[model samples]
Target: MNRLVKTALLAGAAWTALSGVALAQNAQPASQEQEATSLGEVVVTARRRAEALQDVPVAVTAVTAQQLENRGSADITELARSTPSLTLNSARGSNSTLISFIRGVGQQDPLWGFDPGVGLYIDDVYVARPQAAVLDIFDVERIEVLRGPQGTLYGRNTIGGAIKYVTRRIGDEPSMQVQGAYGSYDQIDVLANVSAPVSDTLGVSVGIARYLRNGYGTNLTTGNDHYNKDVTAARASVEWTPSDSLFFRVAADWVQDDSNARHGHREFAPILDSAYDTRAGAGDDNHVETRGISLTGEWAVSDTLTLKSITAYRDGTTRGNIDFDNLAGPILDIPAMYDDDQFSQEFQALFEGDNWSGVAGVFYMDATASGAFDTVVGLANLTTLTAGSVDTKSWSVFGDFTYDFTDQLSVSVGGRYTSDEKTGTVFRQQYLGIRSPTFGNAAATLLGSPRTNYTRTREFEEFTPRASVSYKITPDLTTYASWGRGFKSGGFDMRGDAVLYPNTVDGYDPETVETIELGLKGTLFDRFSFATAVFDSSYEDQQITTQYPAGATVASVVDNVGSSSIRGWEFEGSLRATDNLVINGMLSYIDAEFDEFLAYIPTGPLNSTCPTAVGCFVDVSSARNFQNTPEWTGAISATWTHWFADGSEIAFTPSAAYRGAYQQFETPAPLLDQESYWMYDASVVWTGADDRLTIGFHGKNLSDERYKTGGYSFPGALTGDSLIAFYGAPRTFTARVGYKF
Candidate 1:
């Protein structure tokens, strides 16, 4: 910890010295200057109002549309490569489901009963499920990532952090843009957007996109593609300004993914020719569909006050098959279906006075998530069917206010009171054949009575608070300190088997976190800008998910692990060395450890002490670690622009990112964990003088690094080994052309 503090101080000193030198070199008479070049100011809505990024007391990172384009980012997962203290990837066996974590806090299980530690929002509309949360990047204005708790002002309370995707709005004049791309693996992409004024008081916009790509490897058993992409998406929006004081906007979006089921590589088996290749015998067809609609209205009641309302509805469905063993037989196969729907409403009022500013809001949400899966065990000649559903009704009231005592000093405080109700229904049964009768196997017969058939309800209430103090040493430099609390509700385990574990009927407890942070954000000289923060958090009652052998099958359960402590530091900076050259970089480090962990330990043979045995509790704090929490993450990138004699412009960008080795689960498994790795990406773009024609070429993972992102393991559950691992994308390149009219 001392070493980290010293490093941060040294880095700050170095940046100050460099900025001083640059400023001295550039100083000159204003009358003699022909043109001025400086870093642009960034505006963010982190505090429920538009403000300069450097002036805000919270820690946030904003990525603009041009930045995303330069990096060739396709979806939300790619943002992790450049963002600090963020880990994002696709969940096991699915390509569209997202698993995300920030600062050592997040959720890996995409089940119905569990709540995500990190919140995902699109234009202020909260997404309630992870099933289709890996949104594609197109027609977007910007993305904001808040690092700490966001309980006040946000519709949904998030403990780890929050990610907001802001889309482009309708313009005043008619416009059209079309882009096409061709890449490695026969990848083809088309995107089109159009906007026009319908009347003097209304404007409309529409966008459509199609993305297709060949698989990185082949499925030897099914003769189908593996790790492929096939998606179609569309969005429409209407904006109306009836009067100078009133405004309204309605937006709707839809997405469908028809990609084949992604199969993993068996780590205990012989190495295949390609990391993406598999011999799974499950069906190849997989589908995911998601849609949402939102309406927002704002009224400027007076010069010092404004009223706003937001109403939204969203739904998604996923159907897929997973071959856990990656073998020809159905040793460990799962056929699953998931459905989720949500409706949310929020109202807010803003106040701006001479020395104070504040926002008060009330929010309500009604949501339901249901899923079912059949686990087929051919080696045991039996199957287990697990079906469950969870309904959530939540309401909250929040407010945040800031007061300026003087021009250089300010104080802010905020709080949120939330009430959450969760009702869950679970059913588990055994079947006689290789497949379950519910999965269309008519010959299969029931083995016995239902293992678990019951419904449970739980209610949770919490009051989270936040406070911060800020001081400005100069107009361009500011320092701040803040404290905040966050919460995540808990519910019943969907795959619980009461017959094996009698306590499975009782659900886990909610998790909470208290964090304290100190930060600095400012522009040194006009050419350099930076932001840094150091934080520590106390996490309590963590909900840990684990799989255990139950009779002849495996049951998934969630327990309240004792507690943990997490500390980390983040640094992000950008330097404009020359008029046309810019350099950007970020570095972060996290130290997360369990303070206490009470784990159940078996004392006898599997069958002797299995169902009726009372296990002993053991403190395994020293043996367990946090999942998907890398210790060191860093990235560096540079962009250089050149102008030709014909007035055309071309830009070149090159970047690289590094991530330290980390465990995928609490219990470390060598075969399922990923090692330290680096990824390299580069892009070159050219634009015509008119700024209407553009061409770009991008290359990702140039070194062809093969690394694990997620996996599954169930030891002793089946006769053969069931250790499977999923890999990220291999080397790929693309060429693109775009035009605007």
Candidate 2:
């Protein structure tokens, strides 16, 4: 038997065993007069309109605030454990920077010029940068994850997928809530929310949160905590409804993270006994701040027509240090700073006829991103300074409509036309000291001439389309087929060395994907529901980023690699075995391969294929693999509730998640890849008789699984070994309390 097939079978067996246990518990005898219970309906806005989840043709997953609270989720990364075909992690050295992938496609480099494969949105406003995108969970109503292309209705064009975070709206009545939690490593968290109505047509709301925790490990050289958290966040909103046909809202939000710089564990010789402990020499001072504000207006022109507008602006700043070589000496140290800002406006018109409904929108955005970093090599008394800035302007117009030929059959189509222009400025130079003059050094001397100093611009235009057909086999069952196209514009590389690679001045071309999918969503027996999908995609002009040695420093290159093919299967289901017990499970499998990869390979004496030069360009598709794409991911969970005679209640929830082995980079590195692993979590909560007071205890990673999330491998690039790995958190326990009035 094949190894992958065997592993998948074992995981499926475990899930079945767990399900059998839940079924046995539900088989107990019940009172003769006990009434039956059914699952509630789930409403979503996946198509820019509110509709039932089963009625939508798209493949999406919706998670409610109650579900998050029950699982004791802290940040967006937790979604990966429940959502199939999704992966998320914190960037290398920053606590708030996000790295996301969906369906085997995504970008890992968080530089100023690179674009993210998965888009992130807050209340319909797009976030242009990933520097401070790892949002904390507080005062949020729900979150939605869309699996495929989402360019028709959204404010931006995302190639792989999109994640939407929706905030809680102001209520009609006055209310206040406060929550607190304390846990391992002296963790302390406080969250508060308040809402009040000023008049019959006006209302306001405010939310505040504070999170603090000690590090999981310590820095031996700096005596600072590692992998700690210290953050403050707040949000405010005002709503006005002057009349019955018009509405307006204004919202503002801010977040600041002051956590210490995160360092990776050395994977070479013995440096420390613990995986989390580090001896990095970089100073421990890191900060990130992000703020945004938006205004939204809606007006009803007629009984079947409406118009809406959204305007938003956001900005962020980051300062941090990264110790590439986690040792006592500054063999490969980096100090970096980033600044980014974006402004966007969107206008939409929605219409509803007797048998047709649709939405048309126009979006425009202008953004700027800039960053600089100093690579210090104390052993050689040399420092390389690299700085770059990118400015972007883009606009798009899109529309989607669904027409019903019959009550049981319908067809939908949508298309988007987008134009993007990017301007980039790159600068790279060398200095003769530990630090550069740009990074607060006053006496640093210039070593040689600048390697790269140029400005360039590129423009790209694309039209993507989507179509779907749906039919209801029965009132309780539905099936659909869809095909969509996705695109992502390319830009110049920030660290490209023009002296060595002259072609870097022109930049790379855009990448695109076209996928076809078939899906089924239905319910049976009023107690079980399931959603399944099978998809195949053709990817073209893929942009690949690589690092190579350049005389005394490292050079970053971006190239338009060849094509690829990807196929996957996803399944999500929930069963209500009893009125008080429910079980949920998800399974996903993906097979991604490079169809053609043209790369530069070194030549050897024994290989006479190309003997004229030191290297030759050849096809290396069979030798490469997709990064961060696991072959199989599975999860199973159960929730049970019990009622006391005095009207009090308690709920018990337990879950387990599994992920198969995957590489971290396109170039395979055995030492950096992570093997298959499983994680377990459980929570218990008790509510008082009045239902206004609650207490909960939660445990995560119960088995204390030690697994890698990300890493860096640059063998023989610096003085010492440069193989470092970052790990997920270990076992943790927390107790939380809350009150409402």
Candidate 3:
């Protein structure tokens, strides 16, 4: 008893035998409008106003587009596996290198002046580097997810929350849709969209997607197959309302990712036997490309005021290789590249009165980034190459306010003021005895020196605030309380901090948070629905990075390392339970820690708790918490639909998700935790009867389970084989077809 409570009581008896076989096949019955008495009104814009996700008071999770194509979610780590406090990873094998953690903050080294406590947007712009934030959930029309601090109306690094990606517009009439899928390794997916109406006020739309696969490990020394996939994406939009107070919208997008390389495996061995025979003798590959454009305008200035504007530009590039000693020679190798560009602008003014309403905004951004990397050590080839360039500029002003002293009470307030500036330039090179020439001048006089250039600059400012209160006790319930503040900014650490002093390249400061929440949202008897939230956050100057051991190579630094806290809760529910059953559930709990950290511990044993021997920074703050956070997460689903008698319909969905043990770096070595897992997914569909042909089948994990979403640690003094990890994806199935016009 007590092996994590007997594996959570055998995963709660396999979720009660899968919810008693989906409530005994929906226990028959009929009518009553197919039992759905409530749980419909979702609509959200989180607070850029468009309410009703139970009248928003924060804590969101939208997810639409038919629930992301019925859970076959295309990207962003498959919509973070149905969002149970979201956690995603793709780093190393670059699916555009995404690494997102929510509720426990984010940014786990997409390295380039790290920043990203979860915030990514599209439509409200803002998607500044995580190597251009792993988008690709094409044509989406929903995906809100605003969990904790969204700094006074989504401004800056949202302290662990914010993800919008609302697309799908431009429509007046005509339409077309197409989809295709095939699976299990020969995988392929395709999608298309079209919309029409070109005058009488204009409208247009276009979308496309492509995904190809064939790779699940098999690099037994360059026989190729290190996570293969070639991705493609596209989008376009246009809309104009030539009158009725003017309006306009324009959009553009593009993405590409040609993959291979990201099969780190090597879980302790010279060549273990599992991860499908992983070896990758360095013929690695990875590529990424992105493009963007946006424009929006609106004016109505009189039916209760309104004015808006948005402009954007984005660019990206990333190239890679990271066989990082997964064995097969070349000691430890890593090849990297990155390039970036950004531009932004925003303006807003909104109003409504009767008791008040609000919105106000102004924003500006500029960016540029550059990268280079090469690190190969040992085997008589010690080389290092590092390069950097960064430039950033920012500005902001924001506001949000709401009042309604009656009609069920309300209160809201928001504020934001930000400023940021960053600049950097760096370069370094080292090579010793690259083929002997008198041992290359005595190993370049003991490991090269001289080809160091530096420049750094920084500036930052912040003012974040938010407040909320709500009540509506019955009109279908609602209750709320909130407070917020969050900011993240501070840069420079493009490696080069060999203990500061003259090795120059320092600057690590801003990281702040403050949050409090309490919530409830409801609807009951009308067939049930619920939501709950509880949070407490605090953190300050909490930026920490370490990778010490430099002499035989390995250096990464960044500091501020102290202070942290988090407490959480979330509960969600739904039920219809008959007339064709429906049930949904979610539960999450977090307890992140590190209330005063002291970093430096990437692998152990260097006695004396020394101040140095090669590395040592102790105080691991009671040892671990917060890193891909998962203090019990859960999800459940059940759906069924059936109708016939010529009108066609068939649907079935079964889902399960669970995560408990977690840790993927915050240095807790032992292959970096990640246990307690469970995943199962299923789907089925068939339609026709004027629904414009459809068919489907999907399966995932389905109990095959073998997990680890990420990990890295090469100790044995830098790879003589020591922990590499990164596996997730096994058991898959797919089949699909669709059409409409």
Candidate 4:
């Protein structure tokens, strides 16, 4: 059978198995209860059953809708800002796909074969492809960010971590809300949501959001400033309850985004010399279009059993000329890079009562993509390359069970056996064959090879398991411990133009993480709550995919020799000092390094002439701390609200963060030591119209800290030559209006 057909068959088989399991679950026994309070000891579906967060014994952080809005975080990147134990990395720039690292592990390459280390799920359905994840969060019930390797329970995208955006489902209500905001940098955002019942057994909800912003940097050439973006999204859902025992809901969404970059840089001067590089110039645009639909069903066959099924599909396209340099560096131009990922997935399982529950199901996913690239030097073309298609299929069977030894003590265990098949073919007709470049001959070679043709296929079967134990020592306190395995798949590197090494197919090795962690979750004085955890994780065969040489078209890959471990501690607490005074804070620290890293310079241009190549592979025999990982990162926030004798209220919230400096590349000199930065953000709100409306004025970055929040250096481009960093957004003011009925 053809590879694609085989992949499809396996995927279908997994889903079919899940469907049968769900059917069986519908025929078992169940549990029903009234919804719990927002900040109480709520249960998490991540474990395949409803268990209190403190009772799960896993490293997880949950954020509510109110908190998200208060922080003005609309998308994944923004969400990562406040999320502890997490950091965001990018290959292209600001608008590029996000690579999230939890406990310092993740993939940073934006290639056809490399998938994100972190997984994003909506409801119980997995959003299988990365491109489809570009959509923003509009109306959400809550967001749960799970750290550590979730291999056993969450499966595939959970190799590093998992992010579940649980949207607000149809509740017992009829309501409507509208909100709008205008901000500095010529920003505007509008949102509206409406929910109602069509019949006693049916209901529907609809939401829409529009966002736009003008450039924050000047377009040296167009004089027509850019770097601004505009996005519009719409979501609608229909829910039906045929009887007290059955429920079904389906949702669909659409989004389109268009934006450009104000590619700027610091030359000898930031004013007169606009360092205009065509590749980084304003004529280029980065854009994406997305469409997604999903369906969910719930059936209570008996008082003791409940069955659930979740299915989702997404189709998307991304096109952009991601500029490498800001006219201030040697990074080359990446023009017309195109990508598309079509995803389809389904999950099914059964649930028993809260005291004892077991869930068994299968997961399947298929992702395919193709891309093109045009590399030029100073508007004059150097190489025109094309990359072929890549197809990936992943399937797994997973099960989780929890047994309550007593009302206060229980143990839960889950495991997943996964099989992954990947196939890719990159052809470079002329590009790969060029030896001595004669302008005419090189162009001819490039056209012939188009690019070097590389076809690779790899398959892996892995078993990951997790077990946890929790105990309620007291009514207000709970403590637990857990351990699990997580893994990232291996893939071939992207070789667009005729790279320095035509045979350099630095295939990655799957990174493995084994975590042992303990934590405490407690509520004190009836007005304060906190959770603290300390963990040690060992990473084997670490895949370093972000270390591309400066000016190189592809990222450099390396594997750890001995083994690496990361140990860290995290503590978060919130105090309601009074009815009108509240304070919250979080602190995190991590220590990560290579037990041993046997580095070697392959026979390539990178090892041929840097500082005479005297110490080409010198570090291979030693151990060193991992580069680019901050040792300490945390934040503190406080907000207070006061009411006058009248019907109006005002509030103030201030936030701050601290991050330790780190070097990007493992270089002796020319290091990019990203200095630590501290920032403050605050907002004030006023309400009127008998509490039906609210108007607010807010200013983020109250102290316009001019610092680089993120960055990386490419090795192929030469150390420090193409080093780039994303500067923190400048302080801005915003005004908002909202109404509810």
Candidate 5:
């Protein structure tokens, strides 16, 4: 840890020295002067309306296409490393199923009934399922990440924040772009986009991308590798403009993934082996498919008012088999599959008045989720299968109104009333004879029913509200404070089997959060832009999943854990150090803890809370913190672009990110605590004389830092070695070339 800090400090000093020298040499502009003096303004739609980043009161970071390309970012996980107060995680080694954490709130399990704390959207269309949320970046204009509660504007399950991916529109001129990259671990990526106008009133756009990489590690027992990636995606869109006041667009996309399951290292093995070695004897045959379509229409009713509508539908599926034990013989194996679909419609009216500006919207969504997984033990032909399905219908009415009393002072208020109805059925069965007589009556005693089937229906509703006030101290500076509420719907715990105490199909209660935030935004020296925010949030009825004792065994169930709170601050900025140099920095600090929490934990190296010799259930409330909550995280980067007298240019960018150590679970287990780590990345690009062709070299994790992102475990009474962990990727390098015409 000390070494990393020293390296970062040295790099900062070196950059500072270089900046001074560069500024002295380029004091007088040889090229354009306007571009050399001030940083470009960043525009965002954080408030459901287009506004300058400095003018909006919310804490947001807008990542441009050039910034993404410079970092060689392919997915949300890579992009998150460069942002403040945000983290991305993947469960069971499947990138298609993502987990996002913002301000200590997120869903760890991508199950059928659970809801995500953060909202995800593509061009204002919400994505309802985590199975389809891991979208690849292609032909995107920008990505906006809004921190803190956004339930009033985004509606439902936005207790943490929201992420928006906005794609570029089809232009009138014919254009094409092609890019390809090759890197370590036999990785290959390709992307192509083309747009053309068919006539004066119609235009079309198309994009395709393919990413392939070999596994980073090999299985010693089966001679097969894991963590490989094989994915492909395609998108098409059409735009129509029949009149000057009316516009419409329709788009469709398809994606497919065929990769191996996530691999893990044995925690209590006899031999201390290499970190990447695996002993699983069976193959992790994983596959996923996704398809979606959207239609958007807009009409200008008047000069100050406009109406917009969006309709969308999406379907996705995932299938995989995993060797949970990670042993040569595979004592425990899991085969899983899931399928989901969703349809949604939304309408909005935007109004701009002399003293007031606001937006009103109505939204409707219907979704279905289903999945099943089997537990196969040893060479026994016996299998315990758990299957379930859920159907959900949701509706909401939301509005936001802002009134300006003066040119320098304004206040805004908003609220959303949302309701959801959900129904589901669970079925549990053993294909053959029960493995043990002790496990035969799994559900009979707990639910007073046979281990056959159970049906349940539930309804949840909430009214979330928001209010804020801002004062423009100066034309270039703004200060604001806001208060808001967020809510997540109730759902059943599908992991409960016959051996569990909560075997009945009872739904959990909804969780809610209230937050207060203070912020400042301004421009300095006409060359630097900065934003800062301090916030506090209180959480109630936080949903938690844990093991519950039935008789002689334990079953997994979901329940309302307890209350919690979090306070944090963040600052982000960009500086035009020189005519051709730009420097950016982001820093964050958070203090998050559970005010009250009680749960059962497996007796292992990371926990010492079991009450009995065989690991008995006990309350572990006052001994731990929230899962995956890091105290401090931030990133810094510098870019230098120098244009030659002949108009060609070369650029170099160096970036680094740091994350403080934090607990991976709500336990006192040392194995679940990840240590602090740092990652370094850099890129160099050169543009051709015609400015139509480009080439670049990039490297990620240049220091080869190895860290654990997630893990799995069993009770000490169930297995001799109960814990295993998954590690992040190692150092990788890539070279790329691109052409635009």
Candidate 6:
């Protein structure tokens, strides 16, 4: 074994032994136990079956309710900052633009066919849209973060692993908790959770949370409010347990976000803009409404077999402006209204015998998103162009099985065959600077179809695969290697060329990743545990989008070309420093490149007077880096809890993180550079009598680092060079409180 692996093994063994001894007296944190910070076992279902974190052979990280609360973590973006082999970001202060990458492979585009690189599951139900996965944590049991490509199980999108938010179930006891907080920028949060038994056969629980914040940036031009973010959401669930072998739960959730939206992060200069910005602007009006219902059924068929089924439906509608401009109000136009409806269904049969365990299941998901949006093309006069509806569907059958041939050896294999179909039609495609004869005809002769755009993609399939093996050589340590393949479906890019060119162009084929990982998982010291892994992933058929010239207008579309690869390492561990002190940390590094890529020249010198400009773009660059992906990410946190002689409880957490630089475009111009920066966070918590009352002080962005987040720009066919970029957020803080009964 390598020296690093040997050292890691030795440390893990020592920590486990030490932790066990201290658990007898110390109150340390445990994720699966009923108590807080107590050395207890944590149960996880990432492998399609329940297993202890220590016993599971895969690389995984989990945070319990206590840890999350102590860290003051409430959203997926924050959760990503605390985990290894994970990278998270939001563009324009909207969860709709969430980007998550694992081992340096991820999808950042919000398009019809391109799926999210990471899978987000709440209570075992897959979330449909990226926006729906906001993941507000309340009454949560634990959050399991599985790293690597999980193409073998848990359905599709599992390529970059998955995040499972396990919530508190309806138990036999009645419980209640209420919390409220107020902080800088007029930020306010209120939350409540209550649980009760309806009868001997039924149990019910309800949770509600409200978050509000006033504008943080002052607009110098229009005196408008900017940086205003708010959300109000609630959830209710009912559990039914009639027999010893069967259990069922039904849940409903709703969320409404109301805030005056300003322009997204705008760029003042190249390589100088961060993604998060608090700029003041005019035309501040943006809002969203989302609601969903889900039902889950679990049955223990026998001591060795179990069955699970999950079904859900969700709806969302949004209005107001999406992009804010620095130019005239012409740059400040509102998007046509848009609504989204999605449905998901899944079933799995799992078996766990003495030497064999596996799960088999089928999953189906579909979403239809239709929105109205306007585009600008004139130089002196502002023209508003409109676009209309889009839809898509996907389904798959997947399974995985593992068997132990002996006490020290085990092997597992898994795969999924997924099929996807998508279609869309533009009702009122506007040619901002030109005249149009027709808009709805996808087949209009390049001469008459100017009013509408029609595009359709159908019947695409992906076959993802997974394999792994593990061996326990000693009582305290185990080593393993895994191989998995991930897939991302290809579809239309709505923002590419704008309305002139319809989407009828062929959407690119799906992309794939072949990842191989090796790692060790162990516990030692009676007080510590650790996991480390190294991976190499090869990617193929990368996607690219560009503007296509059609007569007097520009129509943008997407296509796939070339290949690439990436290599990375990840390690994480936790220590019970003392009876009252806990320390945990994670680190990751990725080296990514374009082994092969096709970059099309987006624009060329054109007549400045023409309202519509287009050039015959050519593939000028090959094998280029992808967009919005960084190479390294790491985080560390320490939490210390203490009890007063008078019986009051107090806890504190200090945490920090850093993300390495990466390129903004597949073939970046001289103006673009990779992002490299770090951030810090900390929280202080107090517990009152019988843990009924609690007050907490929390602060985020302690580092106050300035960075750029999303979007890209290139030279236009017209006179102006395409200068598109957004600024990231600056350091901010807030204080919060909660009560329990």
The TM-score leader among the candidates is 1
User: Residue 155: error of model 3 in Å?
Assistant: 8.2
lDDT of 5 by residue, 197-273 (tens): 99999999999999999888877777766777889999999999999889999998888988677657776664336
* TM-score, every prediction: 0.95, 0.94, 0.35, 0.85, 0.90, 0.86
Estimate the overall C-alpha local distance difference test score of candidate 6: 0.66
Model 2 whole-model lDDT (C-alpha atoms): 0.84
- Model 3 C-alpha RMSD vs. true structure (Å) is 24.7
Clashes of each: 0, 0, 0, 35, 6, 46
Backbone clashes in model 3, listed as residue pairs: none
Against the reference, the lDDT scores of all candidates come to 0.86, 0.84, 0.75, 0.64, 0.77, 0.66
Q: Write the per-residue lDDT of candidate 3 for residues 338-382, one digit (tens) a residue.
A: 888889998989888888889988898988888877566656467
Q: For model 2, state the Cα shift of residue 639 in Å.
A: 0.1
Error of 3 at 217 (Å): 11
How much lDDT does candidate 1 score? 0.86
lDDT of 4 by residue, 1-741 (tens): 242343344334433543353233212111122112223466576676665676667777888776766666657655555667777543435353565677776655556666677877776766655653644658788888888889987776576788888888877788898999899988899999999888898999999999888766665555544446578888899999999999999998888777664343432212233222222452456677777788888888887777777777777777765444545332354555546655555565676776888788887878777775544333222344545677878888988888889988989888899888877776543342212142223433443434456777878778899888888877767777787898777655655332434433445556678887777676655555667777778788765542444232443434444567677777676666556766777767777777766554544344434333322343442434555467887888877777777857777777887767654443422334466777677767776638678887777777877655444444333222344455546788889888877
Candidate closer to the true structure by TM-score (higher is better), 2 or 6: 2
Clashes of 1: 0
Worst 10 residues of 1 by lDDT: 30-39
Model 4 lDDT vs. the true structure? Answer: 0.64
Which ranges of candidate 6 are over 4 A from the true structure? 1-40, 93-97, 111-114, 269-282, 332-336, 378-390, 426-428, 431-448, 495-504, 545-555, 602-623, 669-675, 712-728
Q: What is the Cα-based lDDT of residue 361 in candidate 2?
A: 91
> Can you rank all candidates by TM-score, best first?
1, 2, 5, 6, 4, 3
Candidate 5 residue 660 Cα shift, in angstroms, is 0.7
